[model samples]
Target: MIDLQQDDGLWTVTLNNPGKANALTGSMLEELLRIAEAAQEARALILTGAGRVFSAGADIEEARAGLTTSDLWERLSGTIADLPCLTVAALNGTLAGGANGMVLACDLRIAVPAAKIFYPVMKLGFLPQPSDPKRMAALIGPARTKLILMAGQKITAVEAYEFGLVDRVVDPENLLPTARDLVADRLVADPIVASGIARLCQ
Candidate 1:
């Protein structure tokens, strides 16, 4: 489930459903996309999770039903990437599978100091979504990307910060505050000007 809250101009989009560890379902992803589109005028969007795992990636049952999981995931990732204002991901806990795509897509990632960032598709005999590897490579460097995608390394938040996978590693309680600061910092430039520069960076 997706739970949305707005404070000032920052939209906090939290992936709930603690029982599922916030596993993404088709309906949830659809809601996420819709909310993202509607929040384009907001100063920032902060994505987070309600429980110990940020997300377990696409829902297994949804995948088994042959729903367009990959495509839905891509749409979510693309929407996050294309957002005109700053986008931040607050990793309250571990990140795994396709969920990593959203982390890579965000402008900044704030992870709890002990959280693990993992991509285990290799062990499952599944390659990550086509766009994911390239995005990871661009952010954290090609060698690290290989270590992650090819070797299936489980990265800790500290290591991710060192590898440039995440911009900040903070205590769990500090995540939202840190995220807010990140958004505020980005506002140093006007949204129009910032969005223009963001386009060029992309």
Candidate 2:
């Protein structure tokens, strides 16, 4: 399940299936993609989770049904990456598997201290979505990216921050607030100017 909340030009998207660690299903991925596409007009967007784990990646049944290799993951991440707005992944907890793609695509990432980040494509016998590795390498560097994807090392939030995978490690209660604060300036600035700077930075 996904919940979307909008306040003026700010949008917050939350993954709500906590019973499964917010594990994503094919339909959930579709909804997330739709929301990201609709967020094009937003000044800022925050992507977060409702429980202790951001996502366990694809739901077990869905993954076994070919969700692991689906194109929707790439489409969703690409849509987020192309948004002309400040996008932040407010990771509430552990982040694993293909869920890394959307988080990697965000303009910034802030995770709770308890969070652990990993992608087990190697062990799962599937290559990550096409753009995920490139985006991940851009944030944390090629070797570090390899550590997670190739060697299947699960890194703590602090390690992720040190490797540049996550921009901040916050107390769980402050996660969403910190994400909003990060995008505050963009929300009030001239939209055109803010988006122009974002493009230039890219």
Candidate 1 lDDT by residue in tens digits, 1-202:
7899987787999999889988878889889889977977788889999988898777788867754345877777888887887999999998988888877888888899878988877787776777788889998889999898888899999999999999889998899999988888565667778877888886
Q: Rate the local accuracy (lDDT) of all candidates.
A: 0.85, 0.94
What tens digits encode model 2's per-residue C-alpha lDDT throughout 1-202?
Answer: 8999999899999999999999999999999999998998999999999989999999999899999999999999999999999999999999999999999999999999999999999998999999999998988889999999999999999999999999999998889889999999998999889978987897
| Residue 22 C-alpha lDDT in model 2 | 97
Among these predictions, the greatest lDDT belongs to 2
lDDT of 2: 0.94
Against the true structure, candidate 2 reaches a TM-score of 0.99
The reply for model 1, stretches above 4 Å from the true place, is 67-69, 186-189
- Provide TM-scores for the models: 0.92, 0.99
Instruction: Kindly report the root-mean-square deviation of model 1 from the true structure over all alpha carbons.
Output: 1.8
